[model samples]
Target: MNVLLVSRGSTHHGGHDAIHRLAAAATETTGVPVRACFLDGAEPSLHAALDAVPEHCEVLLVATHLPPDRYLDTWIRRAVAHWRSTRGRRARILVAAPLATQPALVTAVGDAITGEHTTLDGNPGPFRSPAWSQITRHRRHVLVCRGPRCTAYGADHVAATLGNRLKEHGLGDDVLVTATGCLFPCNLGPLVVVYPDDTWYEHVDAGLAVRITDEHLRDSMPVDGRRPRDSPPL
Candidate 1:
């Protein structure tokens, strides 16, 4: 099993550490000539990473934390296409979840890579286990939409405020908030979603965010809304 562990520059601290540890273990155990690639500040291209894998090798992508959805999906599709074109089939792509959350972006990446919806647990061999799973099973998730339009409307602050509020509520263990690049309906951002119900909210502000944390997230009440559909495929 020839392994390629690709780490992203933009992932959270915990996720970065976890990927490094996994890379070390995989190299030690398999002795399969593992190569580690760190996507540093948009400088290292995904195409270059794909090209780095040798022909006839069994490739596994260990995405401990992924970049924004726009970049992640484009890269996944390109990688799949490239592998099939050159290697005649898609490599076994295994993705570890992000450090904290379980937003639609995570689902999208998993779907794109594995062509399946199930989450990976334990040592899937050559691939390491996700770090977050050991701490707890049930985790609260907050989705921050930072798509091109949403970022233009100050989505970063929305993500920061939600993280602070979750900490303030002393629900850090139970909650994980993440800022994804986009969630479609760019006009309505900065949008937010809460899972496992997959509740979607539009035009979210600091006050509305706090209400979500208190009324729905903290209290376990359903926010009055239906789940939004995925964006139309590109």
Candidate 2:
């Protein structure tokens, strides 16, 4: 059986590299070819990774995360179910317990925290990428749900299309796009919630996402018939 390590990916380049390193270590330790998949904020998301798996291979899925995020656990199960049902494949997907639940983690943490080890006192600089030209100038935040349903339904494509459209229209500075966890309405995904206006759009696709960027993101005129009814602001 092949192994797949799923992680909560980071936007920072170094953070992403660390996840890759973790996957490599797992592969070395297990003597099995391992693949990496991200939860959010990176390419080759869990759905994409699953798609890359051969139709006949059984997979042992390892969540390489600590603290056991409930959202990730739920989404992982859902993604596996969706993959099996949609593909109608015989691949056996078995989920391993999260790394945090391993007894060795406690000892490892204890060993790492030696008596001589202590944090240095210093002021950390701005926690943002320099490539974000208008990081401090964002007028609105666009939250895209990257839940199981949303990801399976093409939320990644929606995010990419929305971002590109915003940049093409020179609205990137005004709007900041964020990949979020489940928005509570998984069935209505891929979903997007814009704030501080709190305008929520459900069942969004690349075309509808771009339309939102053009109408609501650009001029604050929310597209008609997309917003959820009676839903509170997010």
Q: What is the lDDT of residue 32 in candidate 2?
A: 90
TM-score (C-alpha, index-matched) for candidate 1: 0.43
Off by over 4 Å in 1: 1-136, 229-234
RMSD of each: 15.7, 4.7
Candidate 2: regions farther than 4 A off: 9-14, 40-42, 113-119, 125-140, 194-199, 215-224, 228-234
Worst window of 10 by summed lDDT in candidate 2: 224-233
- Cα lDDT of model 1 by residue, 1-234, tens digit: 555565544656666567657767878888866555443322123444556666556766554443334455345545456546754555555554443355776687787898856767887566556774685644667777755445444455566677788889888878777667557677787788888778887888887778888878789886664575654555
Model 2 gets an lDDT of 0.80
